[model samples]
Target chain A: MSLDKATVAHVAKLARIRVEESDLEPMAAELNNIMTWIEQLNEVDTDGVQPMTSVVESVLRQRSDDITDGGYADKVTQNAPASEASYFVVPKVVE
Target chain B: MNDFASRIIQGATGDWEMVIGLEVHAQVISNAKLFSGAATAFGAEPNSQVSLVDAAMPGMLPVINEKCVEQAVRTGLGLKARINTFSVFDRKNYFYPDLPQGYQISQYLQPVVGEGIITIDLPDGESREIGITRLHLEQDAGKSLHDQDPNSTYIDLNRSGVALMEIVSEPDMRSPEEAGAYLRKLRTILRYLGTCDGNMEEGSMRADVNVSVRRPGEEFGTRCEIKNVNSIRFVQQAIVYEAQRQVDILEEGGSIDQETRLFDANTGVTRSMRSKEEAHDYRYFPDPDLLPLTFTQEWVDSLMDTLPELPDAKKQRFIDDLGLPAYDAGVLVAEKETADFYEQVAEGRDAKIAANWVMGEFFSALNASSGDITQPPVSAGNLGGLIDLITDGTISGRIAKQVFEAMVESGKDAGTIVEEKGLKQVSDTGAIEAQVDEILAANGDKVEEYRGGKDKLFGFFVGQVMKATQGKANPKVVNEILRKKLDG
Candidate 1:
């Protein structure tokens, strides 16, 4: 799909990213180049060629459909940036 | 056949056909992160496992892990996909705080593996083949902490630079079920190969759902990509919402636009996140810093030699060799650990009976304890011992349940538990006959009813006999002696 500069700017806003005015031109040019490359795929005849899904051709591997831990509170909280007792601490949202 | 394609086309007024493909990112199960030697254990202290490399310290260069590559190849072979003799990694330019590296090391044009197929089993015992577009090796981005603070964001680098196999599927699925089945089948294969842990909850495996809608007979519709749908339930919900969104657009005489979208589980809707970029968006030139990866055929062959019996083959063995039902076989071979445990318990025993016990009482015990078969309190050997006791008439099934519980609690052999508890089945005919005589003598009217050809009273007699034995009577022997005494 072709991406325009206006669309890119809007996307950047949605992503909460700040793109400089100077960088916009370069970004647009790069995005256009990518679209052109992907356009090359249109030249190929994929009519009968099945799309590949996996890298291997093996049977499925499964584990018994059993439930396990949503437990391990300490391990879950071990890496929290801020913690109070066993729970993770975050900034209060409400007044 | 009115398959998913036909139904989708029909729903679109026979105008166009919807095409779909998937890109699944499965985290590699390794002792440490791909680049750093920091422990990759799940549920760890958030940033405790982070190293300087993961934190993207200045002047730190990413070093490739050989084990990750081998696992990627093993996965590629499992998929019947081509292992690119040479592949290169490129930096995917993206700005997210979670990505400490600024740019993610991912494959753009040259991925480690290419072109594979996954055959998914449909509900009606039919199978459909989905094509694998590519499987590339990439590093994971860290996480952004948005809920922690309103004005500030935090970064957890524990996940950064962790290895991932970005498996892209062809837009071959037409319905939500097929998409789900495809993901499940792929996950099953990866788990069996021991390449990926396939833990969606741990963020070990995730799906980026690509959905588009078109008229029944028309070309592919504009596709929208949904990012980071971590569970199968969410994957299905995401696709349904995305497809409806596309259909709504077409119905309003507007064209569907190709873009990246986010699924809000709370609202059950997809909102546009970004315009889907073509390949050039990331400027996907091969990385100048890293060399191309190459592997020898001998190494690939050696890995293949060590591959355990996968789900399909194992399922077939259970059916042909063990005479188990197809459903039972399918369930047993879904996971390697479960299959191995079953084999140990089923050896030298009736396969059907073994299956019943494993799937029934054993599964319930595990469930009750909130454990997996891997951590079962009762070992396969102990379970087998319990099954043997039942088959040899040492204990009736009713008595065996009691013994099995004791075994699970104490980790004792079945024989020792039975002996200690005095829980042996009463199979002696003389003893059983004496008990039956006492019961019949006490209940004269019921005994007269049995002699008078009221056959219904026979069950009452049997119940009396079992009660006399304290529920320890061998059911078969009790029935046999009760019939003889009544008939005489």
Candidate 2:
């Protein structure tokens, strides 16, 4: 699928990314390049080659399905940048 | 050559067949995040569980957690998917504030597990086989705080680098209901496998719904992906709206566009987000720093050995072994924990009785108390005691409920509570007969009227007998005695 410059900008805005105006040309070019690379796969003889999905070929390993404590609160909280009363706090916004 | 495909083809028109697919991302239940050893707990303070690796700090390189790989393989086996003897991780380049990493570590050209099939049960006893595409392991991105700030945005990396198994389903579902059922059956299987917790509300598991509309027998229409729908209700809603949207476009002489869309829960519509990109858009190549993941066949065999009775087998067991109705069995075994609890309670007792109490009184009490089967106030053994009392006719159904309430309040066994509180039914024929005689003598006018074809007065006599027994008399026994006395 081809994405025009205007469409790319709109997508960037929706994704909440700040894309420089000068970079839009390069971004569009790179996107076109990527599409060309995907098109190359069409040349391969995949008539019988199954599309690869997962890495392993086996049955799923399972537990007893009993609910247990996930176990690790303190260690999880240790990486917080800002914390108070076991909560990670952000800057106050509302007056 | 089967009649199924022919029927579907004939029902529609032309050579167009509906192709359906699914991509399910299940959050791995682990103590720590996938790449980092930081805790992977839910409902924690925002951004508290993030580690340096999760924060995408400059000197950090991801070391793949071995358990996450095992889990991915385990899930592959569950789906009966082909596990790649060797799989490589790739960097999927994407820029978002929530993704501290410039790119997400995901499986692109080579995933951990490959082609498999998942058989989804339709509404009736009929089942349909949906092709499995792949199951890959990836790291989750952080959360964006949109509601918290009007002008500025904040990132919570608590979920970042958390282990996720992306189980993709083939485009095999034809209808929205089938899609929903596929999701539900997938969730049940994952829950049964213990590979993922399947909690959509907590964002532990989510679906990226791929939908398209085509004529009955035509080639596939341009597909659109509705991303990150967390709940099953939203999944259904998103598909319905997206499918209709595609149909509308096609009907208007405009071809369907292949793109990614966002499902707005508030608006109940899917808005186009961006044109979908192929794999090369991310410049995916094997991660140079990490080695290709390989596992021994022995390990895979052992993991397979540990597999529990999955949902399908368990449902059949409930029907054949426990003699439960298919609907009841399906409900109980939908989640592994509830099914296990039911088994514990029904071990030596009557299965039907146990199912009734568990589905009725037990579930209601748990809901009323806002507790789950995990932390039920009444234990299985105690509930079995209550069932036994009712079964032995030691307590009538009405009195059994009373005793059950006491069991919940006092945390006492049914026998002990019944003994101490004198809640047992007066089933003794002699005792009930004496009470019947007293009621007949006291209500002589009513008794005369009852025998004089005033049959409705029989209820009054039964009520007096029950009152004499302090509401603990066996109701059936009382009715029989009162009827015999009135007829005489």
Candidate 3:
């Protein structure tokens, strides 16, 4: 239920978040408090309960295999910060 | 065991064995994306196929596609795998530029298909069964073109949110050849099911190979994953290089660092991509947007009924019902179209002869002209007619070859070719006896040697008789007359 500074830093790195080193202890403490509050539910004996994926009592809905939305490239990339020739451009990433 | 014995690598200290497993990602053949209504066609204008849900815009929800689910179920049945009526989708968290959603919805705890087995036919006429671990559905990320720009990468979201089946195999394969056979058989099955195209070159299907080396009969070694091998040849090559690389490390007393690697086709080598320190920690959780997928056993059975006769069953029937040799059966049933053609040719004819013609001259002609079996130059019915000529004593097997060549050249039926060319077999005993007497008169000294116990000379007399008759004499009648004339 506790979050250490290193764990917080690792989580931040995984999320690609720029967390200041100076705020690590405070953030870890705050996250620890939240986790401790959430851990209180572990005390309840709910072995037979099923895990819930949705709040609504409905099965997953399926769509037919039809192309109903496309062909508007301009609208598709309208929100891109940088685009060229109908492509979203970002920093080069090679693995 | 003998075939696999050659696959073992001899290190400086001992013989090393390779343990291989494959993870194949096959794109579902569907018109639209997995969770969106956008088109899934390839080679479209960049971003033209992207929908709001695929782009992972805020508040956009995902809806499953019925066709993709049905395809996954059908594929499971084809593999003879167990279908889980209840399965859930989980979000695999990661950070990547191409993955705009920052998480890929995959099946983790409960996969759609459970364990199964696939029997792969080897080149040495032996087969081994490879185990299937699981098959689950996931979303494909958008393609990123890194070489497009100097300092930036161009991203096309057209492939985003496409449905892909991640088929994982057990670490049962001990050789690169086994790995190759396994991929080919799996591709054949996938194509038969019509679930996935299994076109590796077009990027519709690709495999991730895991290779490790260990001393024979020891615990499994640390393995490395080679990512996105696009072809079966490259997959085999990657396993060989990676297995040797691991062997060299172990022989030198250095342990392998379990991580992901990349196979370079040009170099035919695998290089480390990421180390264990930066390994992925995919925290998976059930997605709240979509509920668990549930279906009845009756629905699964209905899908099963829709599956075509897979390669294994067809191969077995060819051997059991048609009395074909295992090798011929394997070759005929490798492709669905070829198998269908064989069946058509073998319909009321000699199965073995039909197989020989289909696998021999028929296949050669098709290959020489680069023709597909689906649209062959010679139809199956015409080939059957050609076989009929030899079966009913219309023409000798030797003359039948000439007639077959003529049929191929002129697109004429076997009967027309036989009639026009006068290539009918002379099965009359009188005509064969006259040719045999002429040969006996000409090769008088050889005939004496044949009566003096040089029995091999009898073949020469038969050859001479066949030559005199222009290869039109029925071989059985020629043999009978030659035996009587020479022996008397």
Which candidate number has the best lDDT? 3
Q: What is the DockQ (computed on Cα atoms) for candidate 1?
A: 0.05
Task: State in Å the error of residue B6, model 3.
Answer: 3.4
Q: Give lDDT tens digits, candidate 2, residues B5-64.
A: 222222222333445577999998777777777777786776567767777767876766
Candidate 1 lDDT over residue span B47-158, tens digit each? 6666666767677665667778878999998898988876777878765556766678888888889999888877666778999999999999876666666755555556
> What CAPRI grade goes to candidate 2?
incorrect
Q: Candidate 2 has what TM-score?
A: 0.77
Model 1 Cα shift for residue B153 (angstroms)? 0.9
Best by TM-score: 3
What lDDT tens digits, residue by residue, belong to model 3 across residues B376-434?
86889999999999999999988988888888889999999898988999999987887
Of the candidates shown, which would achieve the greatest DockQ relative to the real structure?
Answer: 3
**Each model's C-alpha lDDT?**
0.78, 0.78, 0.90
Q: How many residue pairs clash in each candidate?
A: 34, 32, 0
